[model samples]
Target: MKAIVLYQQGGIDKLTYTDYATPEISETEILVQVEACAINRLDLRARQDRPEVDPFPHILGSDIAGVVADIGPRVSEISVGDRVVLSPNISCGQCNDCTDGNENLCSRQKLIGFHTNGGYAEYVAAPANNAIFIDQSLDFSSAAAIPIAYLTAWHMLITRAKIQPGEDVLILSVGSGVGSAGLQIAKLTGCRVFATASSDQKLQIARQMGADFTVNYKKVDFSQFVLDQTNGRGVNVVLEHVGQATWQQSITSLAKNGRLVTCGVTTGNEGQIDIRKMYQKQLSLLGSALGSSSELRTIIQLANNGMLNPIVDQTLPLSKAQLGHQILEDRSNFGKICLSPTLSAE
Candidate 1:
């Protein structure tokens, strides 16, 4: 099997493409022949050893779409030759949170690539329950693009914020995978959408994705713009992922009792919170992680029906994983960047 291994995480040079042994699965797991895998900011941080790096020579990837090449003895629900998308969020299914249908809240929750060797290879081994079957109509690349960005956006806006039709929603970092996905999701309910990006090109793309109003945050105060657009009422919900850089403004752009949901901290972690403002406005600040597997299924269904779409910026061979990381790190890519172990699809 061919894979890009992180020998001693530091730079792109550490991600060396080479042949590695195929993963062996336990009785409760399945071996998937990976067709496509999507690049994420998590992958970049891992490459630079931001959090912590252990167990050297690891494969890094989370968003995976592939075919079941083999299934373990205990996996009776799935079989070989089944096409599936592996859920990136891994949790111990017997925990209380898992039983309550909130697996993302489980104490043992972990991301696939972050906690274990993942899908930057020709084959990946995952729990049988993690593989969600997909119909033949969907290709591997598109399925690979759905797991992280779309699922997080769905959980933030629909499940957490409870967005309603005609409400005003704000989406930040419009060029990101989550940003673009959230823009589309907000429009699904006929909600008025406000989007912000650093460049005009990204703002234009956001408009094409149904953003009602677009702002270049670099040149203008987006929070003030939101207030101006809503006649000082502010937006009903803010889909905020960029952490410290935009955190304060996101809170300020919200109307009274408005919801601000965040999933990532691409900027800096430690953000400032105004206690007085929070209490006075009765604002809701929510932190969301990976979504429920059920939400991923719903996203997949909508995508198959053409109501949602993956914004894939580019696709490269597994050997060129470093190039993909460079594109993402430069913040030059407009959406998801995917790698194909077998170069199966673009």
Candidate 2:
């Protein structure tokens, strides 16, 4: 089997494509023949030796879509030859958080690609519970892109913020996978959506995805634009993922009692917060992580029903994993970048 191995965490160049022994499946796990994998900011951070990186020679990928080659002995719900999407979130199912359906917050949680080997390879063995079966109608590329960005956006807006129809929502960085997903989810709820991107082309795509208004943050102050558009009331919800760079503006663009839910900080991590403003406005600041398994299922159902879809920017062979990582790091790609493990072996 061939895999993208991080020989040493330094830069995108460290991601080398090489052959490796196939992993053995545990009793509760299933062996998946990976077809497609998606590039994520997490992958970039891990490659650069961010604090999130595990031990050396790590396989970095989280979003995977593939076919089950074999199932472990106790895996009763799934079988061999099943088409599946890997969930990436691994938790101790017996823990209190897991039992309560908050697996993302479990104390023993370990995310694939971050803490363990991931799907940047021909095959991966994951817990049977982490595999979600997909119908033949969906292509592997689309299925591979759903696990991270879509799930994170669903958990932030729908689960945490409780977005309602007619409400105003502001999504930052419309070019990002999560940003695109946020736009689609807000639109699905019939909310008036405002999205920010770095370029006119990306903003146009956001409009096609149902953003009511688009702002090129590189050209204008997004917070002022939001206030101007809403007659000073500001937006009802702010879907934020960009960290220190946009945090202050996101807060200022919110109306009184507005909800701000965020999951990632691709920019800097630390930011200043006005305690007085927070209290006076009675604002709700919610920090969300990757969603639960249930939310993943809901996102898939939404896709299956044609209410949502993955915005794929480009697809490359696994040997070009370094190039995919470079595209993500440069922030030039407008949506998810997918990689084909099978093509990497060629």
Cα lDDT tens digits, model 1, 88-163, are 9889989889999899999888788878889999998999999998878888888999999999999999999999
Q: TM-score of every model?
A: 0.96, 0.97
Clashing pairs in 1: none
Total backbone clashes of candidate 1, pairs 3 or more residues apart or in separate chains? 0
Writing each residue's lDDT as its tens digit, candidate 2 over 4-63 gives 998788876788889987889999999999999999998887888677666467888899
lDDT for position 318 in model 1? 92
Supply the TM-score for candidate 1: 0.96
Best by TM-score: 2
